[model samples]
Each structure stands twice: as C-alpha cells, then as structure tokens.
Target: MDHRDMRISDAERERVVAQLNTAVAEGRLTIAEFEDRVDGVLRARTFGEIEPYVTDLPVQQVKPPEESELRSRSSSLKRRGRWTVPRRLTIVTLSSSVKLDFTEAIFGAAVVDVVLDAHSSSVELVLPAGAVADVDSIYTHASTVKSRIEPSGGGVQFRISGEVSTSSVKLRYQRRFWRWRW
Candidate 1:
C-alpha cells in the first residue's frame, strides 16, 4: 500500500489533532470548524484522510513552552478562549482551583493526557460535546471526584490520571444531548 494508504497510528492522529488545534489557536479556524476537523481526525484511518485538515494552515516554527513553566501550579486559574494544548498537561494546586474549558481552548493532540494533581485543591475541566475523557485512574484521599466523562461518539480522546486530596476533580461536558453533529 502507498504511504498515504497505510493505516494511521494513535500518535499520527494526535499530531493531526495538535495541528488542527494550532490552526484554531492562530485564529485560522473557528470552533465549529475545528470540531468538524477533530471528528475527521478521530475517525480517520489513513494519512490521506487527515491531510486536508491542515493543508491551508501555515507551519508554526515556534517551540512550545518549556516543561518547567508548563507544569507550574497556579491558584484560581482558568484557561479559556484560545490557548495551546500540550501533549501532556499536569494541573497542580496546593489549596486553590483550576478550571480548563476546552470548548474554546485548542487541542494539541488527538489523545491529550491530562494529569490532575489536586492536592488539597480542585480541578474542573470543561469539554466540548462529543469529547471523551478516559479517567485512567483516580485516587481520592479525603477528596471528592464528580466526573461527567463518559464514552461518546466522534471526538478527541483525553486520558486523565489524577490524585484528589481534600479536593475535587470534575469533568464536564457541554451541549444539549439532543443536539450533536458527528
């Protein structure tokens, strides 16, 4: 089979997702457009199926932020609007809160691994409709986790592993159940 005809890998799909996220982050795409492309990315089986998503976007030469800065903890943090989504993001807090809304935030990968280090703190992630968040493992120590993450059709994959201590880890999905496209 030709290169484009070969089956794609998870990493490849992620790379494409990252690119699509980047395109949206740079104002080249609207949320609806990105969502549509993400659906195509997740369901894509071959490279030929995903090339169209980023064909019109320019290649970014800027390097992503350093690990130290990206992994830093914050208090009362909220990530909204257009922001770059890293491959792996660790949300940490001592005794505060962090809210990440992916409804408008751009994704950097198809399967973004999100680590919630809710140490005496709380973490809330707001995902778009159809997005799936797979809680790989959750550990609660004097904490509570309210997850609305369930398997859904046609969206990105989020692998979540976290420890909640005297804190809460919540995954929220927005959009009416009756309204869906994909």
Candidate 2:
C-alpha cells in the first residue's frame, strides 16, 4: 500500500484543521468552505482522504519570528496595529508604561509565551476576541495583575509567566466602539 493509503491519526487531523484556520485567516477560504472542509477532514479515515482538502492550498513554510524582547527605562512603549506576533516575548521595564494591542495583529503561533520583568511600571495587553490569557503563574510584589478575559482554552492561549515589582499588568479585550476621552 502507498503512504497515502495509510491510516491518519487524530494529531494529523488537528494539524490540518490548524492549516485550515490559517487559510481562513489569510482569506484563502470562505467560512462556508472551511466548514465543509473541516467536516470532510473529520470524516476522513486515511491520508489520501485528507490530501484533497489542502492539496490546492499553498504550504505555509514561512517561519515566524522566534522571540521578541521589549525593554524600557523611564519611557513608554506601545505596540499596536497590524504586526506579526512572535511565539515568545519578553518585556522588561522600569518606571515605564507598556501597551500591546493585538486586535489587528497576526498570530504566528497558537500559543504565545510572555515573560515580564518589570519594576514600578504598567503593562497593558489589549487582546482580540476569542483570545485568552493565563497570568496565574506570575509573581508579584506590591503589584496587581488584572484581566477581564478568562482562560477557557478555546482560542489562542497566552501563557504569561514572570515577576512584577511595584508594577501592574492588565489584560482586556478590544473595545468595539470608540470612547471619547476628555
């Protein structure tokens, strides 16, 4: 039997689903078409059966940035608009303000790991819809980490682990409407 005739595993199926997600995000497939293809992928029993679902799609061979670091002292740092998010990010600040807006950013990986080392600073992350963050593993000293979004494990996962001294870390969803500030 050929390799295509071999049986497929669940992990392989999930990888295809991830590819389908990327395709949809990149506007290569419509929502309805994605739904149909996902249904077919679920019903597929062999490699040959799943080949047609993505054979026409371009292979995503572009490697995302490995890691990113943002450091500041007595200054403010902000990231907004369309940008490629790396898998790992480190932020170190002292007496500064850092804001990361991910509403229009591209997620390179499903899981993003953030390491924070801050002192007397404020860190704010404005995430998109369906994105969740976990700040349970962070160590704080006279610092407060607040988040309105709960980590339910459905969409993109942000594993935040770090230490904050006299700092503040807040995670919130993007606002749909504009709010005027006086």
Best by lDDT: 2
TM-score of each: 0.58, 0.65
* Worst-scoring 10-residue span by lDDT in model 1: 63-72
Query: Residue 178 error for model 1, in Å?
Result: 14
Cα misplacement distance, residue 94 of candidate 2 (Å) = 0.7
Off by over 4 Å in 1: 1-74, 175-182
Steric collisions counted per model: 2, 0
**lDDT values of the candidates?**
0.75, 0.89
lDDT tens readout by residue for model 2, 45-111: 9999999999989876656798999999999999997677899999999999999998767777999
Candidate 1 on 39-101: residue-level lDDT in tens?
988999988887887788886554444322223354588778656677788777787877778
Q: Which ten contiguous residues of candidate 2 have the minimum total lDDT?
A: 173-182
Compared to the true structure, candidate 1 yields what TM-score?
Answer: 0.58
